[model samples]
Target: MAAANHNTVKYGIIGVGMMGREHLINLYHLRGEGVAVVAIADPHIPSQQLALELAQSFNWPLKIFSGHQELLNSGLCDVVIVSTPNMTHYQVLMDIINHPKPHHVLVEKPLCTTVAHCKEVVNAARKRPDILVQVGLEYRYMPPVAKLFEIVKEGSLGQVKMVAIREHRFPFLVKVNNWNRFNENTGGTLVEKCCHFFDLMRLFVGANPVRVMASGAIDVNHKNEIYDGRVPDIIDNAYVIVEFENGSRGMLDLCMFAEGSKNEQEISVVGEIGKGEAFVPESIVRFGTRVAGRDAVQTLKADDDRIKYDGLHHGSSYLEHLNFLSAIRTKGEKAPAVDLQDGLISVAMGVAAQLSIEKGRFVTIEETMAEHKF
Candidate 1:
């Protein structure tokens, strides 16, 4: 196996959907890091063809499979990236964890559709210490976002008090089979789309979310679209307020119909002493102390020269793969930056927010976790 000697890491990507293909492209850019994508598994024929064309470009002869089990049974991968749909995460993750061979994993985010499933995967992974799994919460690796994290960690912001993230972007892209068109499959819009922001909020606050209060509905987008005789129930816009254990707060303002917006994501972290902000796509960050006043604010373009491919996610996906590869090559010396616990909490936060909107009140994370007796 490629990982046995830790010389070259071989990868297999399950569900070669949009995000999975992004992972493939990111790995392709990381070829200099001693990595190669050896295989891909996807039941959808069109997705397979698209990925095949990509692999052929890289001169990578791939072993394609119709299902994840076949990919696992083949023993062709040292690390497997699970970018399957939100609802399928648990089953695919369980199969990988239970398989005789311990293949390290980098599962795309939200972790699972529900808190119960996230906890199940977390517990299942806990039993396999030899296996390393990372959730693809790659937003943290975004240059501007990473710089903001640094500013906070360096105590320049001084005990962060609030984090407000606004993502005003286009609607979700069409996925294979249109599995993302409904709440049942995508875990609703908040859990499916806003998990990244929720994860970022937790990171900025440096604490787990205690409760979430949200207000949202299917205001626009996919109103007339019907798939399999059902209209899409996924919410298109929402305002979510999260309270962290540290008494700090986080807010997310999401809109799927705002294509005219200049910046897709605008994150502001305010501390007791100062404030810092990150703008995605613009890749800009601004910071200044309260005493320094507005005149003293410093702004800069954020860039990480290590990124060889700036894929769909503003180069964060490339950095994410690099970080995972380093952890795999280091054996037990390093751990995944985004562990299962991080994944679970992120999903839990999203779930709490979703439930909060449903119940029209604040939903506690404790109760959300207790759903499956976690």
Candidate 2:
């Protein structure tokens, strides 16, 4: 492993697709903060073109590689971002951790498509405790979500009992190769998309999920579309309820076809002392105390310019990247904002919920984990 460079952190990216390009763009903006985009790897021409355009636009001296192995062999980066497809995460991450020279990794959400793969990645990461393996659960770093975390941590919302997250947005955007439209590749809608919400739920409730019950189906979008003579099997909507071990419960209401809804994403938490709600897209949060005569709603909005990057999916993504880079520069002294196990547990809830919906029974997280022999 290379010696820590406290002043600057070199970064390499694999699978320069949509999300990968977004990270590259963020890294470009973080150059002032000692972030350097040293290399990018992608097999797809379009992805490579976007990477090149970004490099040229930022005037970054970036090396382009046809494959991630080539970039890894170059030994030009201290931190690597694995923004590959959902199914490829395990293999890509394993390769990175097993490399002779260690590199800190920030992998996109769901970690991997299945429990077995997630465990494999986790075990591989454990072998090298010197390397920091952070998962991209960007929502927790979102301004409003961060504010909510503050409120909860301050005991303003004492004994949080329930969390409700609703995301009513357009159907899944077409991927570079349409790999996201299948359950096998993306781990279904819940794991692919809603893992962020699940991670938030766990954060707010402060406990692991014990039981999950869900109901959903592919009732909209892709109803008439077929690929290679096969219809898309991913669900378009779902209502999942999870009970945490602490007895706090969380609910998710998701609809993929409701694109122009009032709020793209909304989160509400109820606790013994107060109630807090957040509209993520609007960057607004409301809190009301339960004390008599002082029960009034207070509105808060994220006014930080740092979260306002152009073309990013969430304003917090920039912060997420910053957090990961800072962790790497600190030589794992500062833990990542989101650890590897948190990412795995979040996916476990999604997998359990999907199985519960399919089996028409309440599924325990233990059952889901055991089923996968995790």
Q: Any runs in candidate 1 off by more than 4 Å, and if so which? A: 1-6, 372-374
Residue pairs with backbone atoms closer than 3 Å in model 1 (clashes):
none
State each model's CA lDDT, in order: 0.91, 0.87
Ten contiguous residues minimizing lDDT sum, candidate 2: 303-312
Q: Name the candidate that leads on lDDT.
A: 1
TM-scores across all candidates?
Answer: 0.98, 0.96
- Over 1-374, each residue of candidate 1 has an lDDT whose tens digit, in order, gives 35555578899999998988989999998988889899999999999999999999999999999999999999999899999988899999999999999999999987999888988898999999889999999999999999999999999999999999999999989987888998888878888888889889988889988999999988879998988899888899999999999999999999999999999999999999999999999999999999999999999899999998998999999999989888887774799999889888888888888888888889898999896532
Provide the clashing-pair count of each candidate structure.
0, 0
lDDT of 2: 0.87
The TM-score of predicted model 2 comes to 0.96
> What lDDT score is found at residue 307 in candidate 2?
55
